[model samples]
Target: MNEQQENKPLISLQNVTKTYGEKTVVDDLSLDISEGEFVTILGESGCGKSTLLKIINGLITPESGSVSVNGQKIATPAPAESKLVKLRRDIGYAVQGSVLFPHLDVAQNIGFVLTLDKKSKPEIAEAVERARKIAGVEKELLTRLPGQLSGGQAQRVGIARSIAARPKLLLMDEPFGAVDEITRRSLQDELSRIVKQEALTCLFVTHDTAEALKLGSKVLILKTGKIEQYDTPEKITQQPATPYVNTLVNR
Candidate 1:
């Protein structure tokens, strides 16, 4: 880690709250993610796990609260900050569906960000090569449609596109949830390796106990719009914070 990264939080949430007309969704939730730290938010359905990632991505804004990236408080993204535009140019987000455009091919999808930055053609080609090597994207698959991809292949493309800009933090919403068991396992292992190699801070969301345990150095368990437990995955798995947490893990 560099000196700047050591001193700065890649992502910080303070007193974040989101609500509809009558119901609060996420309430006063605060968290910090340091560079290279993988933090997982684990929760049951409707527990606001996905909401937190959206807030970080700036897709959904909080009615009241603040999010700072690289020491700068960010407002909602603008058109100038297109999908290719990194919200902070430091956080990369991957969603659950990972819906790739049916019309675009793998290289085209991965090259999307480079084009937005208006990088030269040579630079885009070089970056694409690196992305493919790092993400293990096959050459032949580059021209194939999303319709032709296996679940794992599609997920790999989604992740590769997210990392093409080389963001310091990755915000993922159950990136592995849709794949089959074997593919999911493979991706998780591959992602762990990539996280270490890239030294990337990641805030990933998942409801699966084992998934959280496998990916996170620390896990935050959310229940009904509140954090019920925040600790290492082993700590949560071995030492439940409450009866509710115990039931969730044990069951």
Candidate 2:
């Protein structure tokens, strides 16, 4: 990548807005996320953290404005399904509860996207092995079904699946939320290592302040669909931009 391209934001949102009935979920939000940044979106429920992720991923169409991922505009008015599919394939997504296909074995689950894309068996196998190693999934567990795995194992499998496609951006919505505290910490440490090793640009949503602070190179504090503060973790802790930010960082 050229220096200019490397310096440019990998993801950009311009005046994006989303509404459900009479309620506005994301209200005229604008932001730019640079390449290789791990941005943690921290907010209370109903603050549009998940909505923002969906919008970027082209899963949720906004009421107005534009979004660009890797310089390609998305979520346009009535986008083609094929285009959305292509876009989503380039962006990895993992959510809470480790939603895996119960019928698929661990290897199949991680290779699911590759299967859909009709990748060769050898290619799929290679991708699955690389992803599992990165996500900390054991080789022996590859033959086990999702039902046979523990919660932590299932979650790791979910992560492996998301990254198997080698996406440029990763969107994670509280991926560790359902696990026990000890498991959560282990997952966090593993994820931190994985992100660095992969040099991924990630947008991770979490309600936990400490998790946000620890995982994010930049922390985005949201309030009712608006940005309260978008700054480095150190700056946020030292110089909170608003009273709400202060309360969040303090409490």
Candidate 3:
């Protein structure tokens, strides 16, 4: 990519809003995320962090405004399913819990997307190996099912599967929430390394204030469906924009 292309935002949201009955989950939210940025969305429960992620990956359609990923318009008043599928293929998504397929063993689970794309056996094997190494998944576990894996191992496999396709964007929603502190920290370090090495843009959602600050290059804090603060982690700590943010920082 040229300088101009690299300078352009890889993800853009404009006047985005999503409502369910009387509740407005995301209200007129507008944000631009540059390529290769690791943005962490930090918020209280029901504060629209996950909702915003869903909108970006085209899992949830906003009631108003627009969303563009990789310069392709994904959300309008109505989005085409075909376009959404194509867009999602380039975006890796992993959420809380071990969301692996029980029927598929580790290798099969990690190679699922590549298999869907009709990749050859050799190509899928190579991608799966790369992903496993990046995510710290053990090669010995390839034949084991999800039910046989520990929480940390399962989470690692989930991450490996997400990156197996060499996605341009990775969306993780509280991916380390269930793991032990040691495991979570290890996973965080591994993820940071992978993001830097792959030059991948990542949007990671977390309710943990410390985790958010530790992981994100840019921290975006939300309150009741609106932005509370968006800035560098250093700036957020040094100069919190709101009392809520200040409390979070202190806490």
Pairwise lDDT winner, candidates 2 and 3:
2
Best by lDDT: 2
Superior by lDDT: candidate 1 or candidate 3: 3
Higher-TM-score candidate among 1 and 2? 2
Residue by residue across 1-251, what tens digits does model 1's lDDT show? Answer: 67875867777888888887888889998877777788889989999988888777767778777887667666433224464245555445444347887898888888777887799999988888787878888889899998999999998888888778777777788888788999999899888888889888888899998888888988899997888998887888789999888987777
lDDT of every predicted structure (CA atoms)? 0.80, 0.89, 0.88
Where does candidate 1 clash, by residue pair?
Answer: none
lDDT measured at residue 173 in model 2 versus the true structure, 0 to 100: 89
User: Which segments of model 1 are wrong by more than 4 Å?
Assistant: 1-8, 75-87, 90-97
- TM-scores for every candidate against the unseen true structure: 0.89, 0.95, 0.95
RMSD over all Cα atoms, model 3? 1.7
The segments of candidate 3 whose C-alpha lies over 4 angstroms from its true place after superposition are 1-3, 90-97
Q: For all candidates, what are the clash counts?
A: 0, 0, 0
| All models, RMSD in angstroms | 2.8, 1.6, 1.7
Query: Residue 105 deviation, candidate 1, in Å?
Result: 1.3
lDDT by residue for model 3 (38-110), tens:
9999999999998899898888899899998877888775567876676677554433335889999999999
